[model samples]
Target: MHIRRRRAVGRHDASDYGLRGAEDGAGADHPDLADRRHQADHPPGVAQVAPWLKAYFTPAEHHSPEMKEALRLSDELVAKLIANDHVVIATPIYNYHLPAVLRAWIDHIVRKGLTLGFDGKGLLHGKTSTVLMASGGIYTDGSPIRDRDIATQYLRLILKVMGINDVTIIAAGGAKGVDLSRVTREAFLERLDSEIELAGA
Candidate 1:
C-alpha cells in the first residue's frame, strides 16, 4: 500500500554465496541449532524440495557453450521463477554492483518476452524474496557509509521491474577494514542466525 525501502549494501567475496547451499539443503538433517531447526521446518504434511541450477556468462563474441547454456538456463530459470512462491538470492556485492556471475545470471533469467517487459516492467507481482549478502565495509545503522550502498537498491529496482516487490534483505557490512572486520562479521552473522530462526514462521 505504501513505498518500501531497502537496507544498505556491502562489499563481498566470491565465496559468500555458499549460503545458498544451506538454503537448498535446508530440509536436510542438521544439528539442533534453533535457526537450523527453523530453516528445516515446513508446513504440515507438505513435502520440501530443493532444485539446484547454475548460470554462466557468454561474452559478446558468444562463446559457444557458455552462450548456449545460458540461453537454455534462462528458459528454465525463468520458468522456475514463475512457478516459485518464494525466491532466495544469495550473493556478494562487487564494487557496488552485483557480482559478475550473479549479474549474468540475472540477465539470463530476466528475459524481455518471458519474465518482464521490454520497458523494464515486471509481471511477477505478489511473490516474496529474500537476499542475503556480506560486505567489506559496514553500511548499516552503526556506520557512516549507509548512503553509499547501492547494490540492494539496484536489485530491488530490478525485481520491481519484474513485478516482484515483497522482498527482504540481510546485509553484513564492515567486513573489510583491518580494524573492523571482526565486529562487522559478528554483527552480520548474528543477523543471519536470526533470519534462519525466523524462516520457520
Candidate 2:
C-alpha cells in the first residue's frame, strides 16, 4: 500500500507569512495548487462508491472546541471519509514540522477507542489518512535539517493505528536544492501533477 501526501500551500497568505510564493503569480508552482488543479481534472479514489468528502480546513479559530471536535469524533470522521472518494490533507510545514494548529487538530482526531483500536490479534487499524507538507526549507530524507521530520513519523503512527497501511509523502521546499526559483517550483508542480494522476489510477 502507498500513502499519498497532500500539501497546504495557500493556508498562508503573503502579508502574514514571509513565504516566497505569497504574491499572485508567485505560488502557481506551489504543490497544493498543483494538486488542486490535477484533482480538478482527475478526481482521486472511488467517488461514486465512497460518497461524501468532509474536508476539515484548519488554522482558523484555534481556540474553538468546534474545530477540535473534528478529531474527537473519530468514528464520525472515519465514516464520512471512508464513504467518500479519497482523503486529502493540505497543510504547510512550520518550523520544519506541522504547524501548531494542525497539531492540535491531530490531537483531537486520534482518539484511542474511536479512530483506532487494537484487536486481540495485536494489530492496529482504522481509516486512511494522507498528508501533504510544505516548508520553506527542504528535508528530503538526508539533509541536516531533515531530522525535523518528526511530523512525518507522527502522522505515520497515527495512520497505523487506524489500520491504514497505505502512505505517501511528497516533500517540497528549499531543501531539495539550493536555488529556490520559479523553475524549481514549476518542476515540483509537474511532479505533483504526475503523482496525482498516479494516485487516481
lDDT of 1 by residue, 38-156 (tens): 31321121011111122232233544664554355455656767766555565666676776555655655566656787676787877776666666766666567788788888888
> lDDT of each structure?
0.52, 0.45
Candidate 2 vs. true structure, TM-score? 0.52
Candidate 2 local lDDT, residue 69: 49
Highest lDDT scorer? 1
What TM-score fits each model? 0.61, 0.52
lDDT score, candidate 1, position 146: 82
Model 1 residue 161 CA deviation (Å) reads 0.6
Candidate 2 on 15-85: residue-level lDDT in tens?
12222333444435543432222213222232222121222333334425644443334345344443433
